[model samples]
Target: MKYIKGIFWLMAIACVIYAGYTLHSCRQRLANNPMGLELGFQKEINQTPVVLQSIERIGQWEFLSIDDEVMVDTTESHLLSPDDHLVRIYHGTLRLGIDFSLCDRGWATASGDTVSLRLPPIQLLDRNFIDEARTRSFYEYGTWNVQAKEDMYNRARTRMIQRAMTPQNIKQAEDNARHQVEALFRSLGYRVVRITVGRSS
Candidate 1:
């Protein structure tokens, strides 16, 4: 009878241990699961018709001379004019390449070999904006009260300034990226021959 009682207690303890483990696993899975919110909530927000400015790279070539029009196939435009405190978007990409040359020493007594060096590609990144909004005219001073028209004009002017600054932002960002890439090449023993700004595309 004592042995039987001992066996029952052991079984109870094993069952309790198993239950604890199961509960822990359930909690872990719940923690890993998503918060059960619907996806695509942010996508719906981005789909609103806001103006976007973008630049495209249309050409690239070897660094032969500075007069070469590297941006032979690109154009620019104003993307959007803001009416109120709305947001505008601009995007662009930079395209570039590298060139190299080799030198040979004739019959060197010590090394009996040749050496090679490379020139980094001339950067051919161009900036441009693509306006997608329908054109609108400024409000007349008499139509809207003079003070109201002045306020509207001032707001529009501010928006235009902000729109114009987009390209400058792209220029600075591309410059920084190019500098970093050049530094990386220098660390790898490649000489940066030149950096050129092609025509605006």
Candidate 2:
């Protein structure tokens, strides 16, 4: 029994000493290398998978948001009756960003500490951005049919898109996407991150 107890105690002391030595070595290496990577520890060489997974997890990442209001009006004239006119104001918010679900299999590639990503170009995230409830009837004369109301709504939607989806806005959104993606890769310990905005996959 005495010999067995001695062996157990000896093993416990050896484990503690080994643990201390490992911790000290890690600290010393961390001091030498600010990156804090130890000799035996290996960072992932292929960051493509990591980056892709991270982007996908973020789902629809919105970079730019535009709020716009549009006024749409329509008039219907009758032969024997007065003309019917309707005017409405619509409010909507447009979100622009890249959808990771549209990314191709070869969207991201990594070479050593550098990573390159080909992402979809920034565009309106949702087509149905108009708030119907927020639409206010600015003016109404006579009775208006459902089709006329729908036409006015469509006109409002088109006008909003034309005003909000300008080339400058799209370029701004793309710049924001690049900045954010680079920051994300840097946080993942990548030394260099290259991103290209291309057609949606």
Candidate 3:
């Protein structure tokens, strides 16, 4: 009976140590990047067929951003007269998916009641998704002889990319793809669907 009690106490201590370590690691991860996944749920996907071609777009997101910039013309050797302070508004869309043109083969295969599939990683489908017509200068002041407006366009693109690449967006796209692919296989009468993605395999 004494031996049994000792064994139980040792097990309890081990469990407490493991739980404390897990909690501490999670806290440190959150402190580093609250949205980043230290371990991705799953990864892996790509390649497809005509049916995939029908999906012209997936994981579409529209975002609006405003940036304040100051361009100084150092060539003018002016303290302030040649500087332009500009506020610009950007309207953009981000799409995540596989490109049909890039898919040389189909992702789905079946043998009897079981089906298997491999998919390409979800990628940024469109980098030139900004609507220039919708973008406008919100506020502008000072000189015309300063820096060109080309940098402003680049800035807008950078901001849009940052907003679109959040962990939530990537996870949502992966979840959507999983559901869609599973449904497609099920519709074709596959009783067993086995999917291998990333390290989750």
Sequence-dependent TM-score of model 1: 0.21
Pairwise TM-score winner, candidates 1 and 3: 3
lDDT of each: 0.40, 0.88, 0.63
TM-score of each: 0.21, 0.67, 0.53
Candidate 2 lDDT over residue span 1-201, tens digit each: 999999999999999999999999888878877575436766667555534344334578899999999888898889999888888899999999988887889899999999999998787888899999899999999998889888888888888888888888888998999999999999998999999997532
The global Cα lDDT (0 to 1) of model 3 is 0.63
- List pairs with backbone clashes in candidate 2: none
**Which residue pairs clash within candidate 3?**
43-198, 45-119, 45-120, 46-119, 46-120
Ranking by lDDT: 2, 3, 1
The prediction achieving the highest TM-score against the true structure is 2
**Every candidate's CA RMSD:** 19.6, 26.4, 25.3
**Candidate 2 C-alpha error for residue 105, in Å:** 0.7
Candidate 1 — which residues are off by over 4 angstroms?
Answer: 1-165
Candidate 1 vs candidate 3, lDDT winner: 3
